[model samples]
Target: MEENRKYPRVRTGYQVRLTHRQYGYWVGSVANMSEGGIFVAELRPSEFTLGLEIDAAILGEGWDKGLPALRMKVIRIEEKGIALAFVEPDYPLWDSGKLSESTQSPNQ
Candidate 1:
Protein backbone atom coordinates (compact mmCIF):
# COMPACT_ATOMS: atom_id res chain seq x y z
CA MET A 1 0.00 0.00 0.00
CA GLU A 2 1.13 3.52 -0.78
CA GLU A 3 1.46 5.96 2.12
CA ASN A 4 -0.39 9.20 1.48
CA ARG A 5 0.43 11.23 4.55
CA LYS A 6 1.49 14.85 4.04
CA TYR A 7 3.61 14.79 7.18
CA PRO A 8 5.80 11.87 8.11
CA ARG A 9 5.03 10.16 11.38
CA VAL A 10 7.52 8.88 13.92
CA ARG A 11 6.92 6.18 16.46
CA THR A 12 6.68 7.57 19.98
CA GLY A 13 5.71 6.29 23.40
CA TYR A 14 4.66 9.48 25.11
CA GLN A 15 1.85 9.61 27.65
CA VAL A 16 -1.03 12.01 27.17
CA ARG A 17 -4.17 13.15 28.91
CA LEU A 18 -7.21 14.20 26.94
CA THR A 19 -10.42 15.99 27.72
CA HIS A 20 -13.61 15.92 25.69
CA ARG A 21 -16.65 18.09 26.10
CA GLN A 22 -18.82 15.09 26.84
CA TYR A 23 -16.35 12.57 28.16
CA GLY A 24 -14.50 14.78 30.64
CA TYR A 25 -10.98 13.36 30.90
CA TRP A 26 -9.03 10.21 30.10
CA VAL A 27 -5.45 9.01 29.70
CA GLY A 28 -3.70 7.34 26.79
CA SER A 29 -0.28 6.87 25.30
CA VAL A 30 0.85 8.16 21.93
CA ALA A 31 1.82 5.36 19.59
CA ASN A 32 3.00 7.70 16.87
CA MET A 33 3.15 11.40 16.06
CA SER A 34 3.39 13.64 13.07
CA GLU A 35 3.40 17.35 12.44
CA GLY A 36 -0.27 16.99 11.56
CA GLY A 37 -1.59 14.50 14.09
CA ILE A 38 -1.10 11.68 16.56
CA PHE A 39 -2.25 8.11 17.07
CA VAL A 40 -3.28 7.53 20.67
CA ALA A 41 -2.82 3.90 21.68
CA GLU A 42 -4.84 2.05 24.29
CA LEU A 43 -7.77 4.42 24.08
CA ARG A 44 -11.17 2.79 24.28
CA PRO A 45 -12.98 3.08 20.96
CA SER A 46 -16.38 3.14 22.64
CA GLU A 47 -15.48 6.32 24.54
CA PHE A 48 -14.92 8.34 21.41
CA THR A 49 -16.75 9.16 18.19
CA LEU A 50 -15.40 10.45 14.93
CA GLY A 51 -15.32 14.25 14.65
CA LEU A 52 -15.30 14.69 18.39
CA GLU A 53 -13.25 17.72 19.41
CA ILE A 54 -10.86 17.36 22.31
CA ASP A 55 -8.09 19.11 24.23
CA ALA A 56 -4.97 17.14 25.09
CA ALA A 57 -1.79 17.76 27.04
CA ILE A 58 1.32 15.65 26.78
CA LEU A 59 2.12 14.14 30.15
CA GLY A 60 5.31 12.86 31.81
CA GLU A 61 8.81 14.35 32.17
CA GLY A 62 8.34 18.11 31.73
CA TRP A 63 4.60 18.03 32.35
CA ASP A 64 5.09 18.89 36.02
CA LYS A 65 6.38 22.25 34.85
CA GLY A 66 3.74 23.01 32.20
CA LEU A 67 2.69 21.89 28.79
CA PRO A 68 0.28 23.59 26.46
CA ALA A 69 -2.93 21.77 25.74
CA LEU A 70 -3.72 21.18 22.08
CA ARG A 71 -7.11 21.30 20.46
CA MET A 72 -7.74 18.37 18.13
CA LYS A 73 -10.44 16.54 16.30
CA VAL A 74 -10.88 12.78 16.29
CA ILE A 75 -10.45 11.61 12.72
CA ARG A 76 -10.01 7.83 12.74
CA ILE A 77 -10.89 5.00 15.11
CA GLU A 78 -9.39 1.54 15.28
CA GLU A 79 -9.50 -1.49 17.59
CA LYS A 80 -6.57 -0.25 19.66
CA GLY A 81 -6.97 3.51 19.51
CA ILE A 82 -8.06 6.73 17.82
CA ALA A 83 -6.31 9.19 15.53
CA LEU A 84 -6.44 12.88 16.35
CA ALA A 85 -5.67 15.76 14.04
CA PHE A 86 -4.36 18.98 15.47
CA VAL A 87 -6.65 21.95 14.90
CA GLU A 88 -3.66 24.13 14.06
CA PRO A 89 -0.89 23.20 11.72
CA ASP A 90 1.81 24.29 14.13
CA TYR A 91 1.85 22.98 17.65
CA PRO A 92 4.84 23.06 20.00
CA LEU A 93 6.28 20.12 21.87
CA TRP A 94 7.46 20.33 25.45
CA ASP A 95 11.06 19.81 26.43
CA SER A 96 12.59 19.26 29.84
CA GLY A 97 13.71 22.44 31.72
CA LYS A 98 12.10 24.62 29.05
CA LEU A 99 8.70 24.74 30.72
CA SER A 100 9.96 25.22 34.25
CA GLU A 101 11.54 28.52 33.33
CA SER A 102 8.36 29.89 31.83
CA THR A 103 5.99 28.46 34.43
CA GLN A 104 7.87 29.57 37.49
CA SER A 105 6.19 31.80 40.09
CA PRO A 106 7.27 35.43 40.01
CA ASN A 107 7.54 35.48 43.80
CA GLN A 108 9.97 32.60 43.81
Candidate 2:
Protein backbone atom coordinates (compact mmCIF):
# COMPACT_ATOMS: atom_id res chain seq x y z
CA MET A 1 0.00 0.00 0.00
CA GLU A 2 2.52 2.61 1.12
CA GLU A 3 5.32 1.19 -1.02
CA ASN A 4 3.35 1.03 -4.24
CA ARG A 5 2.13 4.64 -3.98
CA LYS A 6 5.74 5.67 -3.65
CA TYR A 7 7.31 2.98 -5.83
CA PRO A 8 4.85 0.74 -7.71
CA ARG A 9 4.37 -1.92 -5.03
CA VAL A 10 2.71 -5.31 -5.20
CA ARG A 11 0.25 -6.79 -2.69
CA THR A 12 1.56 -7.77 0.68
CA GLY A 13 0.87 -11.27 2.18
CA TYR A 14 0.97 -12.58 -1.34
CA GLN A 15 3.03 -15.78 -1.43
CA VAL A 16 5.98 -15.50 -3.77
CA ARG A 17 8.50 -18.04 -5.00
CA LEU A 18 12.19 -17.47 -5.61
CA THR A 19 14.78 -19.53 -7.41
CA HIS A 20 18.41 -19.21 -8.48
CA ARG A 21 20.86 -21.26 -10.49
CA GLN A 22 23.34 -22.07 -7.76
CA TYR A 23 21.15 -21.83 -4.67
CA GLY A 24 18.62 -24.24 -6.19
CA TYR A 25 15.20 -23.35 -4.72
CA TRP A 26 13.43 -21.44 -1.93
CA VAL A 27 10.03 -20.04 -1.03
CA GLY A 28 9.10 -16.77 0.58
CA SER A 29 6.25 -14.47 1.37
CA VAL A 30 5.99 -11.03 -0.09
CA ALA A 31 6.50 -8.52 2.65
CA ASN A 32 6.10 -5.71 0.21
CA MET A 33 5.83 -5.34 -3.54
CA SER A 34 6.07 -2.74 -6.28
CA GLU A 35 6.39 -2.54 -10.00
CA GLY A 36 10.08 -2.01 -9.53
CA GLY A 37 10.70 -4.53 -6.73
CA ILE A 38 9.46 -6.94 -4.07
CA PHE A 39 10.62 -7.82 -0.55
CA VAL A 40 10.56 -11.53 0.28
CA ALA A 41 10.43 -13.29 3.67
CA GLU A 42 12.38 -16.50 3.45
CA LEU A 43 13.26 -19.05 6.12
CA ARG A 44 16.77 -17.66 6.20
CA PRO A 45 18.55 -14.61 4.98
CA SER A 46 19.26 -14.90 1.29
CA GLU A 47 22.77 -15.36 -0.03
CA PHE A 48 21.57 -13.65 -3.16
CA THR A 49 23.33 -10.33 -3.31
CA LEU A 50 22.80 -7.45 -5.64
CA GLY A 51 22.78 -8.13 -9.38
CA LEU A 52 21.64 -11.75 -9.18
CA GLU A 53 18.88 -12.88 -11.49
CA ILE A 54 16.03 -14.91 -9.98
CA ASP A 55 12.69 -16.27 -11.02
CA ALA A 56 9.75 -15.07 -8.90
CA ALA A 57 6.18 -16.28 -8.73
CA ILE A 58 3.35 -14.20 -7.32
CA LEU A 59 0.68 -16.65 -6.15
CA GLY A 60 -2.80 -15.62 -7.03
CA GLU A 61 -6.35 -16.91 -6.39
CA GLY A 62 -6.00 -20.66 -6.91
CA TRP A 63 -2.90 -21.13 -8.97
CA ASP A 64 -3.90 -19.90 -12.38
CA LYS A 65 -3.74 -16.27 -11.36
CA GLY A 66 -0.20 -16.88 -10.24
CA LEU A 67 1.82 -14.03 -11.63
CA PRO A 68 3.62 -14.90 -14.82
CA ALA A 69 6.69 -16.19 -12.96
CA LEU A 70 8.96 -13.36 -13.88
CA ARG A 71 12.63 -12.74 -13.32
CA MET A 72 14.15 -10.05 -11.16
CA LYS A 73 17.54 -8.63 -10.36
CA VAL A 74 18.45 -8.40 -6.72
CA ILE A 75 18.75 -4.72 -6.11
CA ARG A 76 18.62 -4.70 -2.33
CA ILE A 77 19.05 -7.22 0.45
CA GLU A 78 17.45 -7.50 3.85
CA GLU A 79 17.97 -9.66 6.92
CA LYS A 80 15.32 -12.16 5.82
CA GLY A 81 15.21 -11.69 2.06
CA ILE A 82 16.02 -9.61 -0.99
CA ALA A 83 14.41 -6.83 -2.98
CA LEU A 84 14.13 -7.29 -6.68
CA ALA A 85 13.14 -5.40 -9.78
CA PHE A 86 10.98 -6.99 -12.45
CA VAL A 87 12.94 -8.63 -15.23
CA GLU A 88 9.63 -8.90 -17.06
CA PRO A 89 5.89 -9.03 -16.29
CA ASP A 90 3.39 -11.11 -18.30
CA TYR A 91 1.69 -7.98 -19.58
CA PRO A 92 1.20 -4.40 -18.53
CA LEU A 93 0.71 -5.28 -14.83
CA TRP A 94 -1.48 -2.30 -14.16
CA ASP A 95 -4.09 -3.19 -16.79
CA SER A 96 -3.91 -6.95 -16.98
CA GLY A 97 -6.87 -8.99 -15.71
CA LYS A 98 -4.55 -11.72 -14.45
CA LEU A 99 -4.08 -9.79 -11.22
CA SER A 100 -7.17 -8.86 -9.24
CA GLU A 101 -8.83 -5.53 -9.94
CA SER A 102 -9.26 -2.92 -7.27
CA THR A 103 -12.67 -3.00 -5.59
CA GLN A 104 -12.72 0.43 -3.99
CA SER A 105 -15.90 1.07 -5.89
CA PRO A 106 -17.45 4.50 -6.57
CA ASN A 107 -18.90 5.16 -3.12
CA GLN A 108 -15.69 5.98 -1.35
Best by TM-score: 1
TM-score of model 2 vs. true structure: 0.63
Model 1 misses residue 77 by how many Å? Answer: 0.6
lDDT of 1 by residue, 51-95 (tens): 998998987664454646889999999999999998964644545
- For candidate 2, write residues 1-108 as lDDT tens digits: 534345755567678777877788778888887667788876476467689888887775655663467888888777877777877656665844454446544554
Worst 10 residues of 2 by lDDT: 95-104
Q: Tell me how far the alpha carbon of residue 38 in candidate 2 is from the true structure, in angstroms, after superposition.
A: 0.8
Model 2 alpha-carbon drift over 4 Å, by segment: 1-11, 88-108
Q: What lDDT does candidate 2 reach at residue 55?
A: 87
Residue 16 displacement in candidate 2 (angstroms): 1.1
Q: What is the lDDT of residue 12 in candidate 1?
A: 73
